[model samples]
Target: MESRKHIRSFVNQTWQLRYGAPVDDATNQIIWSFIVAVLSLGAWAGAVHSGSLPVTYGRKKALLFNNVVAIVAALIMLFSRTAQSFEMILLGRFLYGYNVGLGLSVHLMYLGECSPKKLRGVMTLTGSIFIGFGKVMGQIIGIKELMGTEEMWPYLLAISGVPAVLQFVTLLFFPETPRYLYIDKGDAEGSKKALQWLWQEDNLKLELDDMQKERESTQGEKAKTVKDVLTSRCVRWQLLTLIIPCAGVQLCGINALYFYAFDIFRESGVPEDQMHYLSIGLGATELITVTLCSFLIDRAGRKKLMGYGYLLMGVTMCALTVMLSIKDLNSWVPYVNIALIFCVICIYGLGPSGVSMALPADLFLQAWRPSAYVISGTVNWLCMFLVGMLFGYIVNGLGQFCFLIFVAYTILSAAFLIYFVPETKGKTMIEIMEDFNKLNFKNRAADTEKTDVDLATQF
Candidate 1:
């Protein structure tokens, strides 16, 4: 335990340097929410638009294309004052949204294929950490007095171009995911070369064996298609398990809080002058908690961390709701609300925030992974949109009762996790499936024996 804690701490520090500042905490709440909502909404718009096109582009091509569009959008936003027009901004947001939806799916698929089975979960979480960091950095920039000027919001929105450029450039240097080269593209020689570049000679044989096993399992099945994802019971169930938790995570109201931190703090009684600094603290704490959770996720197992995290968040929200319901609405009420919000943030960062993003690939076999990712991503964004759109209305309409909705969702999330979600720690993808199969079997004695055997094998 001690060694694990030390390792987690070391990893947290290393990741912090790699990802840089998290999204800013102190930006004006209305603007922050608008930007996030637009970004998320735009991504979906772009996805639906591009998806309608019959382009048969491969993952790499798709990534490049998306980046190109994102760059173009960012440039337009940066240069022309007319770009600030709501309709034009929406157009730009649509393109960015499509890029995000497509890019996220591709990136996860690529990362899953490239990562070793042993480290896949952690690598997956790395992407989430970076995203959290990006959110924090954005919040920081939003709050800066110099940047907070009306002229600067466009620049802040355009800054996403930097990462898009880096991603495009970086792709040129790294080899394509070997599994994609071999399984999807059927370029065996190319796949071998890519694997060699990615892994040491000593590790290549073992890794190749795993890849071969995955390929064989997928061969007889229909090639991964959108149809398969929508139709397959296995794929559908996995998608549901992943999507519900992900949606639940968002509906916990973290994004709304993050997007509206200044407003939330203000409502809670924080002075306008100190809102930005407090927002910064919120971002810092989020970074810290997510960093800690990334290190512990594999060790602690997915189900426990997520279930408990939801429960904690739900409880804190309920407490805040009670405080808000009081007649006085005293200055202390805001402080308590802020404290509860922070607690919710910490729990979320430590568990569902990372795990929900990481688990789809962990649960699905490679053959189904791409489609699985697409479905999960679509559902994730849809829920994000739903929450972003409705949170304010709920808060305004129901007042203190608004929190009960989140509480209900959180409780539902915990129940689903405890009853339905399987533990996926320290097991190979194949082993995870096998364990899942055993648990699903109807014969109690046989299922028990299989479960015991699988658990023994994992250790």
Candidate 2:
């Protein structure tokens, strides 16, 4: 984002002005990084509550409520200068991050359940595409030619509220997700009407049949909380599926790639002035590839796409490590490293980035879905925080060899997903669960025995 790095000097100047003297520069650096990094921490904080809010308020109302939080954050940043409190900016960023954390998690659930089986993947992946678009727009607007200047920086930061405002207004025109209506609320007629409105068709018999089966499957199951999700063994494999891949999304060095892309390009002997353009090019590549994936997902299937994405990323990292190690010995190899980095980004956008975000919704049913979101969201946010905090240290400590760590991560993640995770692209929710059942439920009789013994011990 423009505010991520470009706003640094401007914000530092404002701090100096507010203090009426020069201050320790390292303190300013730490504070600025904390303000930027705290968003993910706030996201992790909000994730624990993500699923419950949607469950309690219904998806539409929950999002509307989140929009208010975003508005509050924007107002705080807008008035931070007047109050002469840098802490306000930190508070605003945290609240903004919280809003995003909740929005990103629940929006996928809303999209997955609202869409027909055929369009579900694309609909859910639209979130990633939107994010990519936002990143590009932010970068463009944050350029020196635009609002990245000191006087306009506050407006640039405060402008984040615009999307929330628009979403709040536009989402009002949309109806509640049909699955939430039918499955969670048990409103058959209401669900049917929502489906009709959303799909613009009256014949939803086949769609409703899928919801009916899911409802039957969860017929009398009580509501589950975060504690319930953590303690349940029935969802162990499902939990792993949701977690490993989602965490893998970050561990694959996505943030590192973007955060240190300039360094990478510089090391590759790219001209200084052109490096930013090259960086922008990579961002565009991500946006375009993710957009392509959104179209291809239903046809290609999630397991194949995700598996190969990680596979390709692992393979590219292998080459990158070799290139980084050997580039000092040759003149042309830096270009090869640059190309491989681009290749990794392309593959990442194709599968891991969008697919990981959509997986929890596909992997769980109504009864366990909320808990799955909580766990998966927590993993997603935690990994994001870890990556933000530790990546610079890892890069500094390991030098060029640092990529090998990610290579190992990618290879293992790819292997697990290919062999263990099922394809959920065209499958109904019931059918996806059935596929997982075949893999995880093979030893169900033994599991039941273990469950009984454990229950007895508790008494």
Candidate 3:
């Protein structure tokens, strides 16, 4: 979807043919924004159901089913230009978004369950690594030498289906996550087999014992509903922990930075023709940072990485605003602004972008996991949709100061994590749950202590 920026002109041309007239700039901007934003709308729709599908079909099968949606969307994109129908593009974008929404949640759930506690943080951040990898691939493929040409744009749009097909074929051979098989389905033998298949190790007594303990703990709880997750007082801090970081991933202005990358690059004296290549460089910076994050997350712990990551990003954004303000003061200032842009992306990829995805999986046990993911995905896509729709106005209204909005948000998110969220690295789900319980019931605990004091005074 990041690739859409390169293909926007081609898409506009296709719509122009459909309109049978010259499309004015204003109308074209609206159409383009709708095309970009519509995917988030579809993702919001798909996220609402992300929880149910995994519970009903199991993670592997649900993900396999989600791939079908992508294939179908791909076919729509493949023929959209031939059909001369912009509506096909919209439909295709929406379906792709839906596929992403479902895939993102379920993929995280599957992997989180599959990972051992020792390697859970590392494995979870791997998902973020690939997400950045995908953006890099998109940028690379969308360059003019490849499919960014007007004649090849439709093929570019449809190319996502190839990976979907690949995953569908490859996923059939792998068993469902062992935790899901054991805890959710109560098939200890099947879970053992899955563990063997996944790990290629027969000495699995400890892993099995852990799952058994978790299963016993969650014996009677069914999968939680979204309402159950939202309204339940017991998990209040868990919900806050999930909600703040997930929402911050979108609200932090990284997407807006990408949306306005060309303008920023142009202002910095990058040639228009070379801007696409610079975009690839931008994507690569995040890819590298996230790859490093995968190594550091377990050692550094989630709270520090995310808390400090946001703090540093806030500082960087402030610097970016200052640089943008002073770009005309010296020729070298624009170059400094460009460097700060890359700095912001690096901080984001290391912290909120990667760690946020792991929170739902870490915070909730099996019964609450699905609903937790649904809320996470909903906040994610909804914020994305809003950013996509409103960022243009933000840029026009606030100009360089637009970054300050994200700066404030990033600082507050950092404070929330530092003050409220606990470190999840090297902790069992039960242990992590206990950590949140203190905060969850802190008020009640305080009340009880106050009553004890009152009773002592009376006595």
Candidate 4:
């Protein structure tokens, strides 16, 4: 939503940018920047209401409804050119943001619920993989030779509708996640049928029993509200873990690094024409690495991947700062600088990019799951907007020293993970909560030393 929000401004040969803008210069700046920034706010807006929809409407149905947001948002853009109104563009961007914010979180929840624990890491992470693919596709389609031309601007904006359409059609055949049916709706027979269809197993006793244990753990608790999520003591550690990873994905400077990646390549004295292809190389590198992550996550474990990945990224950022500081010092410095930029992006993809996305679904049971997603989604989008809005100012103020901020964040986050973040690989939802409960009780030595709990649980 942020990237594609400026199609008209960047592709100035378009009719919309030439003479068709309905607004004046100040208004246009406000509208375009406002629209770009509003997408994240829109995501944050929709995210506030995300939990209610999934709990009340069911996960699949909520996502189906969200698919409509994309279709409508695209139609709004498709008509913006003909109507000669830029307000439609603003409206469209917001709706697009709303769809993605709502879709990504819910899809993760649904995918996590649908799969068995053994395959859950890879299954849930396909959400992040699909998102990476979308980013690449968006860039490819936005190329001026392709859909980014004058006549193609509106079509370029509306192309996002295609994925929603495809999902709407195919999602009909798949049942609601068996966990949702079983735990949320308390429908044993229905859940059994759904699980059978999804897992192709005649027996789901093992899975059902696990869900039952989870249900018992949250036995007296009502479905948590946003207020509930904030006020509840039991979920403190869970909330911290969720927020840390979710917010860390953005705050660790992934988006800011991508922004810097382009600048680094351009400043490397690479030709402008070749820079575009180099940009694609960077995207492809992230795509391949993140895709590889899905498979490796189940094998290597989330904490290890993230812990090591961030450590590497921290070292790379420090290296980048040195390179940027000394780019004029040597003939070969520019090339090495570009290589480190790609290396930073690659390390980002290998660990935090996908693993952080999976943390909510991995850590929470159905009772806390929806609320966890709401908080996770909200923190993630809000931090993204903060980084996007402030990083430019940050760069102006600190120059190359700005990367030291990221290094600081990595140091703090890595230390937090090592000391507190538990290894969640191969754990059931109930077991994961048990781990959080251990952390929640970590301060009280009186209650926990005799009780068995993972001492490494996240605070």
Candidate 5:
């Protein structure tokens, strides 16, 4: 879908094959938006199953299966142009969405479980780095000089399958996560071998000791369901912590900003032909910022980086609203809007983009982690769907004021991180849960006692 904006005109040109007449741009755009928005809907549906598939099949196998969906989506999309059917393209988008929903959750789970505590933040953040990289690559490939032309657009859209195929082949040799083997499957020897394979070390006593303690704490508890995550009093703060940041990822308006980038570039007097290059720059900015954050996350801590990222994003967004409002008042004002847009993306990449993805893995233990990811992935896709579908209306109705709504959301989410969510940097899962229990069990006098899944079950 990253290439959708660039390939849209080409895609619209194909509608004549179905109608036997050229469609008006208005009708074409309506259909186009549906094609784009349907991906989020599919992602939401896939996220609902993200928890169970990984829990039942294990993360590695779940991800391998997910790659097959991406392959199927690619095959369908590749033939849509030849078939002269836009419906094939729509179905392809939905399948791609489903692949992403499951991939995002299971990918995070697999990496998080495999990471040593000291390197966890950095390891998990690699996902954000790759996502940013993929966006930039999509934009680069979507350039008219490459595959964005009408004749090549279908092949460009189908390119996602190539990577899926590559991953499916390469991932077979990799070990399942040590945490999953030890804690979830109760296979101590298998876990030790996995740990050795992952870390390239013979001395894993300390690591296995930690996993044993975690396994004991979560003993007798099954992998939790999404309903359990929502309804349990034991993880109330953890759920809130996961929900707000995930929601903030969409509600913060960064995607909307990207959606409106061409308009912003137009208002700033950039040549229409040059706008795609600028879009690539925007993606590059985020990739660079997230890479920097990956290094800083463990040192500066998740809460501080996330809180400040949102706070700074709120400030940048407020400035952007003013800049957009006054663009006609001064010749240079529009350029400042462009700069502020970059700043907001940088701030988002620095904090919320990467940190939000790590929250579920950080906050929940083995039994609860799967369902926590379900909640995280669900909020993410749902909010993305709502915003993607309604943002055009919001811009038409509110104009520059649309950003103020995002500012409010960013500020509120920032405050929540600062006041409530604990920093997970360098902390063991047990330690992180204890920090959360201080808030979850704040009203109970017995909060001083050790926290366990059994206690959560008793509630």
Candidate 6:
């Protein structure tokens, strides 16, 4: 186990550098955000205009078509022959969203399987940093050009392909996830070879043993079927605990504050032009906070940090909401809002934003992991889309009530953590499963006791 941990750590650290080498986190974020923003425009165009491509392609063909859609949209924008319309822009954004949704799920599963218990938290947190950094980068790029400029937006959207291209090339040389090769593909020899590549002359038996244990635990269970997830009470419970809180984490309004930092600044009465520059400060603080949390998460214990972090975020968000509500507030009101925004971002970075993604991947058994992750990822993106689309409307309609929603979510999330979520720190996959199995045993005992008491009363 110790040797496996060491090997996994080395592999994870190496892959982190390799994946980020060509573009780095900031650059990747910039590219991805630009694509998302551009694709948002394309989606709008498709919905509104009659000229766009038909939307009925099959899944495999649709995915390929989507990739082509980005290229085609980019070309249309770049050539500048056709008059720019919201429809064209919307098509690009819709395509980007589809691609991102798929990519995010696959990558999360890949990262979770590749990482060992010791370094899993930091590895997952790194993905979040890249995501936030990408958003900031895209915003900075967008801020440099006029929002409606046809030339810049398409190029920015297309730039995402550069990293995707590089990733495709790099993955060609890298070994597939050993777990995938061993279990899903049923290629024992290939799995051994991949483990050797990952460990590079380290103890291969240790890694194999770890994999064997995982396989045994998951064997004979109908974990692979979607019906298993739906029908099994324990599986259903685990799925809910994993997905609901993760979705709730996003629905708490943090993304609104993060994504629309500039809008928030403008609403707080900061000059519109200056909102972009001030957003850089917000991004910097977020990066710092995420970095700190990544280092501390494995050491501090997931539950303690998450529980405390949510509490802190709730208090800060509530205070900010209250400050925003006061009539004739001091000149520092905007700055206070920014401060509270920073605090909320920081607290979330320390907890939900960084930790929640890692938890479901950790808690679900290996056989059920990919399915659980699919649900979590789907819920995450769905909630994220919901918040991103409706936050402005909510704030406009309900005003301070929006903050109250966030506070309520934070409180409920904290309550969930305190009552049910277990600390995953330093626990192996088997150990974690054993801990959960113990919970099942205890519950069964309680049920039996209750039944006996009822029987005695009847007699």
Candidate 4 local lDDT, 206-225, one digit each (tens): 89999888777777777778
Cα RMSD of all models vs. native, in order, equals 11.4, 4.2, 2.3, 4.7, 4.4, 12.8
Superposed model 3: Cα runs more than 4 Å off:
1-26, 449-459
Answer with 1 or 4, whichever has the higher TM-score.
Answer: 4
Pairs clashing within candidate 2: none
Residue ranges of candidate 5 with Cα displaced over 4 Å: 1-20, 24-27, 446-459
What global local distance difference test value does model 2 have?
0.83
- Can you rank all candidates by TM-score, best first? 3, 5, 2, 4, 1, 6
Candidate 1 C-alpha lDDT tens digits along 1-459: 122222233333333454674323342234334645777876665444333221245556667777888898887656534422433554566667777877776666667678776677788888778877886787677764656554465676678889999988987788878876776666778888987887755457766776677777778664466567677655554665777787876787686556545656777666777866777788788888888887888788889999888888888878877876762657676677667778888998998888887876788876667666666676778887888688778778886677788789898888888788778887777777776665445376687889999999999
* Winner by TM-score: 3
lDDT of each: 0.70, 0.83, 0.88, 0.82, 0.88, 0.63
Mind giving the per-residue lDDT tens digits that candidate 3 earns over 1-459? 334654566556776676777778897778887887899989988888889999998999999999999999999989987787778989999999999999999998988999888889888888899988898998898777777776788888899999999999999998999998999999999999999998889999988887888899889889889999899988999999999889999898898777667777898778777877888899899999999998888999999999999999999889888878877888888778778888889998888889998898899989999999899999999988788778878989999899899989999999999987889999888889889989999999999999999999999
TM-score per prediction, in order, is 0.81, 0.93, 0.94, 0.92, 0.93, 0.77
lDDT at 434 for candidate 4? 79
Give every collision pair in model 4: none
> What TM-score, to 2 decimals, does candidate 3 have?
0.94
What is the RMSD of candidate 5? 4.4
User: Which portions of model 1 show Cα errors greater than 4 Å?
Assistant: 1-38, 45-57, 82-86, 256-264, 267-269, 327-333, 439-459
Please provide, for model 2 over 1-459, each residue's C-alpha lDDT reduced to its tens digit, 9 standing for 90 to 100. Answer: 445554465556567887876657787788888997889888876777787888888889988998999999999988876676778889999998898888888888889889888998899999999999987777777776788675777788889899999999999999999998988899999999999999999888999998999899889886677776677776667788888888898898776667656776887777875665676788888999999999888899889889889989988888877877888888787778778778889999999998888887888888788778878778888888888888889989997777788888989999999987778878888888777777776798688889999999999
TM-score of 1: 0.81
Flag regions of model 6 displaced more than 4 Å.
Answer: 1-88, 145-150, 221-223, 258-269, 448-459
